[model samples]
Target: MDLANSGLSGEAVYKSTCIACHGGDGKGAFPGTPDFTKSKGPLSKNDAELLSNMINGFQSPGSPMAMPPRGGNVSLTDADLKAVLGYMRTTFEK
Candidate 1:
């Protein structure tokens, strides 16, 4: 899978990158990490906004925690991050 291109498998990308902070259930690893499974969370943002945050990194406006650029995996492409976000929306944002 060429993660640099379009190998945007949500589950795979989540496992390799996001799971550490976001957790397997998308509940987040710590206080500042947004609970994707929760109704009022990152899912509130649109895809473009979310993608931009994932790529550029995001610091919590109300908290000290932040998601580093590319979730700190730098190796992941925009598509990869998009897929992960899409997957999160589909699976957890309900």
Candidate 2:
């Protein structure tokens, strides 16, 4: 599928997997929620690190909810994560 069509599916992936806490627009509902629209937080991190964190929950000393391993949704595949990541990047990474 084209990027546009792929993105459409990606939107669904994002909604089902990320919308609760990240908000419908990926703006986040609570504090510390990364504002995807504003490109805030650790945007400087490379894609590899971001992908790693997306696959494996961060286990640092200060993480809340332990980042919820794969954001607590295990059914997602790597492609789904990539699609969701692409969606977030397009939505907020401006």
Candidate 3:
């Protein structure tokens, strides 16, 4: 996807890389994936914590699988992660 030069918007990144599990509406598609609409859900975490998890990968308490580093797209930069994070917060947080 040439992410190195694409400068993709957060929504684009989310659609291309995050939608499969996170879903179009931010509701998780998997058995234990987090629901972004909930006030106390994963979005409640601060950016630093969320970024760290995204960079290093994280498995929620009951999630069936761990989110791979950079949502499985290792080419994504810190800026991209932050952008996607912001997008999620804006688009899904209640």
Candidate 4:
């Protein structure tokens, strides 16, 4: 998917890019991935911190793999990241 257009909604971006690992339920499909449904999971962090982590990439403490910069999609803009972050919070945060 060419995200260069910047018109995709957060849910769309998530279904296309994030769902592979984060899973549709936000429980994580991969080993060591954080559980977004947890009350104190990764979503507990403030937006700025979350954005920084998403922008620069992040590796959970025990995760065997790290999320590449921009979730490996260089075409995603800061807006897209924010949108997806909001989506995750609304849909998954407990």
Candidate 5:
């Protein structure tokens, strides 16, 4: 989805891609995955930091479950990633 220009919003992108691992509530589907509802979770990071981690794939120290590069969807563009993150921030950061 060309989210920057396409009518799709951040919530749509997140549902289409991120819901698998992150869950609809952003609580994460499996162990080691971060819980966005928490104050100290990914919501604490800035866009740049989050984007960089997703683009490069994050493997936190002592963690076995890694989030693959582009969150396993290589077709996603930078704008798509940003959109998904925006959804996460607004929906789960409370």
Candidate 6:
């Protein structure tokens, strides 16, 4: 799992890093995960905002997990984040 250089595909990265919480189908887990499929109004938020949140993290006043800074994998590059976001947008946000 050479995430640093294997140039893992978005789907691969998602499966390896995101599926644990976001779920294999991007439906998200219980306890507090946001269900992207059911997102109302506009799931397409500002890319920069999403990127910042992805890289830094989002607490949302009382979020318990704190989003784990880069979703818990600091090795992810900007491109990887963008790809994951794209994957989510294409797959989950119906």
Which candidate number maximizes TM-score? 4
How far in Å is the alpha carbon of 54 misplaced in model 1?
0.3
| Local accuracy of candidate 2 as per-residue lDDT tens digits, 1-94 | 1344333366788788778878886667766666667644544566778778889976434435556777798887767777777777777675
* Residue runs of model 1 more than 4 Å from their true location after superposition: 1-5
Candidate order by lDDT, highest to lowest? 4, 3, 1, 5, 6, 2
Ranked by TM-score, top first: 4, 3, 1, 5, 6, 2
lDDT of 4 by residue, 1-67 (tens): 2335456678987898999999999999988988999998999999999989999999999999999
Largest lDDT belongs to which candidate?
A: 4
Each candidate's lDDT (Cα)?
0.82, 0.68, 0.87, 0.88, 0.81, 0.69
Estimate, for each residue in 1-94, the C-alpha lDDT of model 5 and write its tens digit.
2346534567877888788988988998877778889998888988889989978899865567888998898888778787787778879997
Q: Which model is ahead, 1 or 3, in terms of lDDT?
A: 3
lDDT of 1 by residue, 37-70 (tens): 8676889888888888999999877757778899
lDDT score, residue 34, model 3?
A: 88
* lDDT score at residue 66, model 5, on the 0-100 scale: 85
Q: Candidate 5: lDDT of 5?
A: 59
State each model's C-alpha RMSD to the native.
Answer: 3.2, 3.5, 4.0, 4.1, 2.9, 4.6
What TM-score would each prediction reach against the true structure? Answer: 0.87, 0.75, 0.91, 0.91, 0.85, 0.78
lDDT of 5: 0.81
Kindly report which residue pairs in candidate 1 clash with one another.
none
lDDT of 3 by residue, 1-94 (tens): 1224436778988999999999999989878988988999999999899989999999999888999999999889887888888889989998
What's the residue-level lDDT of 65 in candidate 4? 97
